[model samples]
Target: MKVEMILKELEALGSERTKKSYLQQGAHEPLFGVATGAMKPIAKKVKGNQAVAEELYATGNYDAMYLAGMIADVKAMTEADFDRWMEGAYFYMISDFIVAVSLAETEFAMEVSDRWILDGRELYGSAGYSCYCWLLGNRKDEEFDQDKLSEMLDLVKKTIHTSEDRVKYAMNLFVVTIGVSYLPLHEKAVEVAHAIGMIEISDGKGKHNLPVASVEIQKAVQKDRLGFKRRNVRC
Candidate 1:
């Protein structure tokens, strides 16, 4: 379908309650507030269309950007294209969920993520570390460089407490993902999580403790989900 038609559909799917929730979570206007689950049928119809995805993303509507990620042709995206997407990602939901999730499906995932992490910008670093979480959760263990992941765990241990709020969340998830999905670094991730303990993060509101990664990893262990890998990164 055309971008205009898709946008109309998204607007029809939107609701005031959901829009309020999204606005509360840092989203701006020009959005339909369509839930991710609600976009699935539309995504199924237009699966992996780079041109259409670009058009949707350029609309600057939160729902459209999200739909763009779902239908984006990852293989067709270059680093420049991903960078463009990152630039348009104004909030953590778009940065981590939409951009990072889509980036995880590409060959450029690691290199681009590494650069973004080192960029030391809030949304960029969040997206970068979040990309690792997606990659580790979905890709084969053998696909990663063990040493690089080890270093990333070390980076999180060293910098998470002082990182940007969004980056801290992503970095914490990275450790949990490593502990649960990357068996080679499971022990190290547990050690790092223990050292970090509970991190307090704020999103304009007063600070609150995030979930303890060590605890999360233990839950995964109880479920016999250690070393679990997702079948896909995107919905």
Candidate 2:
């Protein structure tokens, strides 16, 4: 309830860097997307009588933990102290959320996206796409981009002509939907698909599968990640 107390505890936790060396070195069996594992032991190493342990696990991981710290004195939190827990996250732990999205958990994807924007800022691109893809499972929906898959395809074609790595990756995942649905923006997607080399020329029956190559998608994503390098622009 007191800002002074919260600040003191946060300083204590932040000062425990030595105790978290193994975590930084990543030498232990990593619990990928986990910060709680890292925080718990560090909390125990605290010298004072601080209830660091309670704050460390108050929520679950960093996001919740930070929230708990801000909302209440974790070392002395009470049920009545549970104010609006999410007071705009101070520190973020996004690894676990990333893993969850890879599993195609739409609920998780959407939820994470929402939280990232509202609490953590816009550091959730991979997860946002995961949510979009999950919602557009099998690539059959035409609602994406105003149903203008074709427009995207066209852009892809142009990108291919220029060998633009970014367009190539995004477009490949844009196509591969063969369902009998009409995406009003199919033209847009078509341009995009062309740019990425996702042109699956069917046998004039619309009965064949919308073939998608995992390798191509992987390469695209890899490129997308690398595009974040200091030499490139932000995604």
Candidate 3:
């Protein structure tokens, strides 16, 4: 479908209630407030349309940008393209869920994510760590470097508490992801989670403690989901 058709469809599918919820979650104006699940049929119709994805993303409408990720041609995107998308990411939803999720499907996933993690910027760091979560949840254990992941766990142990709010959440998720998805570092991930414990994050309104990674990991374990890998990064 054309961009105009897609936008019209998105507008029709949007709801005021969903829009209010998105606004509360940091989405800005010009959004149609269409839920992600509501865009699946449209996504299936336009799958892998890189040009359409780029056009939709350039609209800067929250819902359209999200749908762009759903229909994006990951292999066709270069590091520069990913960086461009990251530049437009104004909040954790777009950063961690959209840009990072798209980056996870590329060969440059690790390289680009490393740069973002070390960028010392909040959203970048959050997206960088989040990219790893996607990777670990979808890719095989042999695809990752054991030593590098171990060092990352150590880094999380040292800096997670003092990191940016979103970064702390992403890092905590990373540890839990390693515990749940990577068999080689499962024990070390548990150790790091135990060391880090519960994380504190602020949502502009007030502060709240995030779920402890050790606890979440154990919950996944109780469900016998150890080493679980998702078949797709994007829904």
Per model, state how many residue pairs clash. Answer: 0, 37, 0
Q: Which rank order by lDDT, best down to worst?
A: 3, 1, 2
Error of 3 at 27 (Å): 0.6
Cα displacement (Å) at residue 10, model 3? 0.2
Candidate 3, residues 88-164, lDDT tens digits: the string is 99999999999999999999999999999999999999999999999999999999999999999999999998999
What C-alpha lDDT do the candidate models reach, one value each? 0.94, 0.33, 0.96
**Higher lDDT: candidate 2 or 3?**
3
In candidate 3, which residue pairs clash? none
Question: Evaluated with lDDT, which candidate comes out highest?
Answer: 3
Assess every candidate by TM-score.
Answer: 0.98, 0.28, 0.98
lDDT by residue (tens digit), candidate 2, 175-222 = 422111224443444334434543343333443423343333344445
Backbone steric clashes in candidate 3, count = 0
Residue range 39-85, candidate 1, lDDT tens digits: 99999999888899999999999999999999999999999999999
